[model samples]
Target: MADSITVRGLSADAGQTPLLRDVSFEVRAGEVVTLFGPSGAGKTTIAMAVAGLTRPGVSLDGTVEAPARTGYLPQQAAGTLNPARRVGHALGELVGLRVPRMTRAQRRARVTEVLRAVAFEGDLGPVLRRYPAEFSGGQRTRLALAQVLATRPDALVLDEPTTGLDAGRKTELAGHLGALARNGVALLVVTHDPDVVAALDTRLLRVHNGVVTPSEAPQPRPTGATRPSVSCSGSPAAELRTVSVHFGSANVLREADLALFPGETVGLAGASGAGKSTVARCLAGLEQPSRGTVLAGGRPLPPLRRRTRAQLARVQYVWQEAAPSFDPRRPVEVQVAATATRLRGVCPGEALAEAREELAELGLTPAQAARYPPGLSGGQLQRAALARALLARPEVLLCDEVTTGLDTNLATHLLGHIDAYQRRTGAAVLLISHDPHVLTGRANRVLTVENGQMVG
Candidate 1:
């Protein structure tokens, strides 16, 4: 069988503007092909086009030839996974695509197999009973993969699959993808991370300015220098003292101790689901600790609901995945400016101006900012989220994978912006990221976590 996916003279348009033009690509059986490019360059749009999943306003101009069973894992998790549905149930539903009218026992067995393929372990019952909200970002991403793999597609297309995953999980996922390609499955990946490229025997295609072409190699990233130690003159800006957090019977965080001084950026490194996000949530008052204390400015911090406006304004959190955190009904520009207006007491006009300035620095144009979250690409949406968070000008910023979907140029620019802001305001920053490169020179100190405990 000649199982393959081919695109010729492909073009995609949104609201009369071309997002991708004259793009061409192919993925044959037992081959691995990667699309590498800067963010918002329409890499994801091409991926969606190939999978027959383009949005209503997107007009396709070229042919997308693929196998009957095509599995697609989109970059945005919000639209793909049902928040209300159990993870296992969602995977089970997708199983029907491959095995129509499957018996209950047969369906259960199939779901379990797919889950295991994604490195999900332990009892199937507990995993099936939990909602998507209960799982960490990496866990949710893996579950999404399982849902797609359950269909047993001959051609697998994934967009930013390693966005929120930890280093270990990324390696594991790369291994799985390599094994799948060896088994004669056609794999097409859209990503910017060189680490992903190092894991697979793949051909590189570059997407830029609405066009696609063959690339010799992945672009080299600029090296970041080590940051000099900054002096702390007063009380710590935020502190987590032997804090612990539990979800149901599972302990997600255990006796974790951390302190952030004014004007210093603290980088937290850990495997996905290793309590990094939980710590940030606790510090921002979004998640309550099961035990111990979270202090702000040397005082015990209250829960998010109990916190005052001033308290809330003192700390801000930028989510790992922007699309899920966004309000889909409104334009992203409005949401970004809302933070400044509500928290900083800036006029609506001034807030919008600041938002526009920040967006421009992150590579989003005025036109792109006018669109809603769903209309924007993954990189664009994540930049919008960062702009919104930075607009608050919080005393302590909790950024969880703020640069997950960004390209090197944009990521470097965003990091420089944050560093400049901290230097100007003497604010503390807790930057959580899977890439250690992000922490170099950016974070005053770096700490590692494993199995819910801080190792350094």
Candidate 2:
């Protein structure tokens, strides 16, 4: 069989900067090819190139041949779905377009089949009826995959497909991809998860700096390693009381409650789609509780739009996937500084200087920080998001899987910065992560969200 995908001398450059240097690879039908690397290592660039959706301002220099029938799961999984429509509508469009001859009933059946292939644990009824914003990161990843699989492409490229998934779910996804390969579909996977890379009989190519080579890079630093130690203060910095959120008929968060003490790292753990994000949005003022109150320092806090500048500055949130948080048109460093300047009335120069310092501590150099959001890697943007929130110097910081895209070393380094910042400023942190190791010694206390309720 002809190769499902081929890239010869694939190089990408953004003006004077090189993103991916002279990379060549091929994936045959029924093969699994993985591009494994550190964050900012150009994996997504190559994946984007192969999928024929290279970003603007980036020029490609080599030849790529992929099937007319191809599918791509973007690194920003949430971007794949139309936020206004129910997921069923999104899937039905693809099903109808890909199989124009199928009846509406047949298309619905096909959508259900694709959703089952991703192995979601519950009924497809609620998932299909709910809007994209209703799902968690991992669930969105699956939705994105289902969108891709709905077309039944000959070649599929997935960027960080296992992100936001629990350990068992990651393993399950890998096995599902393996099954897909066995059925003669080629797959190119870009990921930082070791378990994902280990599970496949993959043509493993390591990407470092801007080069792709066949040699392995250094192993990631394990979690529970040294990070400037954590310490907590007496009072609750932020708390959610009897909070409930509704999406149509879905009661996402039901009478949930959580408390964040100053100078502490609080970890929220749950299976994907268990309402962890609802809790984060409630605390961040992004979502208004349908019936309960969100309080900071024992006083009720309003929705984000209604919050005072001080309230906005006092509670900051970093997203799980930080790309959406940034403005693609502006330099990342400038945007990072905007939080400080806009929120605290700091002078532009001082805000920029503070952003530089915090970014430096998080391992982002001035040059990297100067690039636009697209110019930076997912991991780099994640750190920038953290820096932006920290620049606000909030009493309560909410990090939604802030290190999910980073490699071990950078993640460890970033964690250390959070620790040091907390020690110095007594900022309480709410960490939502699927990786148990990330919360092992990092979180001073742990909370669980089960069936839409918070349990300690």
How does each model score on TM-score? 0.94, 0.95
**On a 0 to 100 scale, what is the lDDT of residue 368 in model 2?**
89
How do the residues 170-211 of candidate 2 rate in per-residue lDDT, one tens digit apiece? 888888899999999999999887767777678889998789
- Candidate 1 residues 134-190, lDDT tens each? 777878888888888998889899998887887677887888888999999999999
Kindly provide the TM-score of model 2 when superposed on the true structure, using C-alpha atoms.
Answer: 0.95
Steric overlap count per candidate: 0, 0
The true-versus-predicted C-alpha distance at residue 203 of model 1, in Å, is 1.6
Model 2 lDDT, residue 403, Cα: 83
